[model samples]
Target: MAPKAKQRRILVKLVSTALTGFFYTTTRPRLGEKLAMMKYDPMVKKHVLFTEGKIK
Candidate 1:
């Protein structure tokens, strides 16, 4: 039987830093540091920093 291939990407939650209880979902490489980006938040109506978080 062929060996099972490893998953290179994972689903993660990006939470807004503005404490607006807003978040986003995206796929990223499994082997790397936590992801962070600037995204628009509808709650605040402005761009904010989003940090990676667990899906659970």
Candidate 2:
């Protein structure tokens, strides 16, 4: 594979893995808050709350 194509594949895999982990955090609400703090955003916590049906 070309260098550019290989790099793209690696980037895609990394993004996919990170997204999977983020979704997993939603299943564990307490841990999700910690993970959200690590992300330096309030959105992750909001998403976790929404996913848990704590918010409409």
Candidate 3:
């Protein structure tokens, strides 16, 4: 039998910068840096920058 390896991915919350209370959950590499991307926000009806936030 082989021993189990540690997880390399973690769940992160991407929050909209528009302050519309919109967010998305996704898995990412366990890097020590934050993630950010541009996505469509239905609340604002436009694309906006989404920054990484703690899942808790």
Location of the lowest summed lDDT over 10 successive residues in candidate 1: 26-35
lDDT of 3 by residue, 1-56 (tens): 99998789999999999999999999899965789999999998999999999988
What TM-score does model 2 achieve against the real structure? 0.14
- Collision pairs in model 1: none
The total of clashing pairs for model 3 equals 0
- Candidate lDDT values, in order: 0.96, 0.26, 0.94
Q: lDDT winner between 1 and 3, please give it.
A: 1
lDDT of 2 by residue, 1-56 (tens): 66652221111111112233332223333323322222322434333221222311
What is the Å distance of residue 54 in model 3 from its true position? 0.4
Q: Which candidate achieves the best lDDT against the true structure?
A: 1
Per-residue error (Å), model 1, residue 40: 0.2
| Most TM-score-accurate candidate | 1
State, as a TM-score between 0 and 1, how close model 1 is to the true structure: 0.86
**Which RMSD does model 1 reach against the true structure?**
1.6
Candidate 2 lDDT at 14 equals: 12
Candidate 1 ranges with C-alpha deviation above 4 Å: 1-5
